[model samples]
Target: MFGLFKKKSEKQKLQEAYQKKMSEAHKVSHSNRTQADKLMAEAEEIAKKIDQLKV
Candidate 1:
Protein backbone atom coordinates (compact mmCIF):
# COMPACT_ATOMS: atom_id res chain seq x y z
CA MET A 1 0.00 0.00 0.00
CA PHE A 2 1.04 3.61 -0.54
CA GLY A 3 0.87 4.16 3.19
CA LEU A 4 3.85 1.85 3.60
CA PHE A 5 6.08 4.47 2.07
CA LYS A 6 4.86 7.22 4.34
CA LYS A 7 6.97 8.48 7.24
CA LYS A 8 5.67 8.81 10.76
CA SER A 9 5.16 12.27 12.29
CA GLU A 10 6.87 13.43 15.47
CA LYS A 11 3.79 12.75 17.59
CA GLN A 12 3.39 9.30 16.17
CA LYS A 13 7.02 8.41 16.90
CA LEU A 14 6.67 9.74 20.41
CA GLN A 15 3.47 7.74 20.92
CA GLU A 16 5.21 4.54 19.86
CA ALA A 17 8.15 5.25 22.12
CA TYR A 18 5.75 5.95 24.96
CA GLN A 19 3.96 2.67 24.42
CA LYS A 20 7.28 0.82 24.33
CA LYS A 21 8.40 2.40 27.54
CA MET A 22 5.12 1.62 29.31
CA SER A 23 5.33 -2.00 28.28
CA GLU A 24 8.94 -2.19 29.42
CA ALA A 25 7.88 -0.70 32.74
CA HIS A 26 5.07 -3.21 33.09
CA LYS A 27 7.41 -6.09 32.44
CA VAL A 28 10.04 -4.76 34.78
CA SER A 29 7.52 -3.98 37.54
CA HIS A 30 7.56 -7.57 38.73
CA SER A 31 11.34 -7.79 39.11
CA ASN A 32 12.58 -4.27 39.89
CA ARG A 33 10.22 -1.69 41.19
CA THR A 34 12.78 1.11 41.02
CA GLN A 35 13.70 0.52 37.41
CA ALA A 36 10.05 0.20 36.48
CA ASP A 37 9.38 3.52 38.16
CA LYS A 38 12.13 5.13 36.12
CA LEU A 39 10.71 3.78 32.91
CA MET A 40 7.28 5.04 33.94
CA ALA A 41 8.69 8.49 34.60
CA GLU A 42 10.28 8.55 31.16
CA ALA A 43 7.01 7.45 29.61
CA GLU A 44 5.18 10.23 31.44
CA GLU A 45 7.61 12.76 30.01
CA ILE A 46 6.96 11.46 26.52
CA ALA A 47 3.23 11.65 27.19
CA LYS A 48 3.65 15.27 28.22
CA LYS A 49 5.40 16.02 24.94
CA ILE A 50 2.59 14.36 23.03
CA ASP A 51 0.09 16.49 24.91
CA GLN A 52 2.02 19.65 24.14
CA LEU A 53 1.96 18.79 20.43
CA LYS A 54 -1.79 18.43 20.55
CA VAL A 55 -2.28 21.94 21.88
Candidate 2:
Protein backbone atom coordinates (compact mmCIF):
# COMPACT_ATOMS: atom_id res chain seq x y z
CA MET A 1 0.00 0.00 0.00
CA PHE A 2 1.11 3.56 -0.67
CA GLY A 3 1.91 5.91 2.21
CA LEU A 4 -0.15 9.03 2.84
CA PHE A 5 2.85 11.35 2.66
CA LYS A 6 3.52 12.66 -0.84
CA LYS A 7 6.44 14.23 -2.64
CA LYS A 8 7.15 17.88 -1.99
CA SER A 9 6.41 20.36 -4.75
CA GLU A 10 8.71 23.19 -5.89
CA LYS A 11 6.65 25.74 -4.04
CA GLN A 12 6.62 23.66 -0.87
CA LYS A 13 10.37 23.20 -1.10
CA LEU A 14 10.97 26.92 -1.41
CA GLN A 15 8.54 27.74 1.35
CA GLU A 16 10.15 25.24 3.72
CA ALA A 17 13.60 26.54 2.80
CA TYR A 18 12.53 30.10 3.47
CA GLN A 19 11.03 29.12 6.83
CA LYS A 20 14.24 27.37 7.85
CA LYS A 21 16.26 30.40 6.94
CA MET A 22 14.02 32.62 9.02
CA SER A 23 14.34 30.28 12.01
CA GLU A 24 18.10 30.25 11.65
CA ALA A 25 18.16 34.02 11.56
CA HIS A 26 16.19 34.15 14.78
CA LYS A 27 18.35 31.61 16.61
CA VAL A 28 21.80 32.88 15.69
CA SER A 29 23.33 36.31 16.06
CA HIS A 30 20.61 38.87 15.44
CA SER A 31 23.18 41.33 14.04
CA ASN A 32 24.02 39.05 11.12
CA ARG A 33 23.12 41.48 8.39
CA THR A 34 24.16 39.30 5.45
CA GLN A 35 22.09 36.31 6.48
CA ALA A 36 19.14 38.56 7.28
CA ASP A 37 19.20 40.11 3.83
CA LYS A 38 19.46 36.74 2.13
CA LEU A 39 16.58 35.34 4.17
CA MET A 40 14.41 38.37 3.38
CA ALA A 41 15.03 37.95 -0.32
CA GLU A 42 14.18 34.26 -0.08
CA ALA A 43 10.98 35.07 1.81
CA GLU A 44 9.93 37.47 -0.95
CA GLU A 45 10.52 34.76 -3.52
CA ILE A 46 8.43 32.32 -1.47
CA ALA A 47 5.65 34.88 -1.42
CA LYS A 48 5.76 34.97 -5.19
CA LYS A 49 5.43 31.21 -5.25
CA ILE A 50 2.36 31.46 -3.02
CA ASP A 51 0.87 34.01 -5.39
CA GLN A 52 1.40 31.65 -8.31
CA LEU A 53 -0.37 28.89 -6.41
CA LYS A 54 -3.34 31.15 -5.70
CA VAL A 55 -3.82 31.93 -9.41
Candidate 3:
Protein backbone atom coordinates (compact mmCIF):
# COMPACT_ATOMS: atom_id res chain seq x y z
CA MET A 1 0.00 0.00 0.00
CA PHE A 2 1.11 3.56 -0.57
CA GLY A 3 0.70 4.29 3.13
CA LEU A 4 3.46 1.80 3.89
CA PHE A 5 6.04 4.18 2.46
CA LYS A 6 4.87 7.13 4.56
CA LYS A 7 7.05 8.12 7.50
CA LYS A 8 5.55 9.45 10.70
CA SER A 9 6.46 13.00 11.69
CA GLU A 10 7.72 13.90 15.18
CA LYS A 11 4.38 15.26 16.33
CA GLN A 12 2.54 12.26 14.94
CA LYS A 13 4.89 9.89 16.70
CA LEU A 14 4.40 11.70 20.00
CA GLN A 15 0.64 11.67 19.55
CA GLU A 16 0.72 7.95 18.89
CA ALA A 17 2.82 7.42 22.00
CA TYR A 18 0.41 9.53 24.04
CA GLN A 19 -2.54 7.57 22.78
CA LYS A 20 -0.80 4.27 23.55
CA LYS A 21 0.10 5.42 27.05
CA MET A 22 -3.43 6.60 27.72
CA SER A 23 -4.84 3.24 26.60
CA GLU A 24 -2.36 1.47 28.83
CA ALA A 25 -3.29 3.73 31.71
CA HIS A 26 -6.97 2.99 31.21
CA LYS A 27 -6.30 -0.74 31.28
CA VAL A 28 -4.08 -0.45 34.34
CA SER A 29 -6.67 1.65 36.14
CA HIS A 30 -8.87 -1.42 36.65
CA SER A 31 -6.38 -3.19 38.95
CA ASN A 32 -3.38 -0.90 39.55
CA ARG A 33 -4.42 2.71 40.10
CA THR A 34 -0.94 3.90 40.99
CA GLN A 35 0.61 2.49 37.86
CA ALA A 36 -2.22 3.92 35.81
CA ASP A 37 -1.55 7.34 37.31
CA LYS A 38 2.08 7.05 36.32
CA LEU A 39 1.16 6.10 32.79
CA MET A 40 -1.21 9.06 32.62
CA ALA A 41 1.55 11.37 33.78
CA GLU A 42 3.81 10.05 31.03
CA ALA A 43 1.05 10.55 28.51
CA GLU A 44 0.60 14.12 29.72
CA GLU A 45 4.31 14.77 29.23
CA ILE A 46 4.07 13.49 25.67
CA ALA A 47 1.09 15.74 25.09
CA LYS A 48 3.05 18.72 26.36
CA LYS A 49 5.82 17.92 23.93
CA ILE A 50 3.31 17.68 21.12
CA ASP A 51 1.95 21.08 22.11
CA GLN A 52 5.44 22.52 22.10
CA LEU A 53 5.98 21.30 18.53
CA LYS A 54 2.87 23.20 17.49
CA VAL A 55 4.15 26.53 18.82
Which candidate number maximizes lDDT?
Answer: 1
lDDT of 3 by residue, 1-55 (tens): 9899899999999999999999999999999999999999999999999999999
- Prediction-by-prediction clash tally: 0, 0, 0
lDDT string, candidate 1, 15-37, tens digits? 99999999999999999999999
| Higher-scoring candidate on lDDT, 2 or 3 | 3
Predictions ranked by lDDT, top down?
A: 1, 3, 2
TM-score, candidate 3, is 0.93
TM-score per prediction, in order, is 0.98, 0.58, 0.93
Lowest-sum lDDT 10-residue window in model 1: 1-10
lDDT pick, better of 1 and 2: 1
- For residue 52, model 1's alpha carbon misses the true position, in angstroms, by 0.4
Whose TM-score is higher: candidate 2's or candidate 3's? 3
Give the poorly placed runs of model 3, Cα more than 4 Å off: none
Number of clashing residue pairs, candidate 3: 0
Candidate ranking (TM-score, best to worst): 1, 3, 2
- The number of clashing residue pairs in model 2 is 0
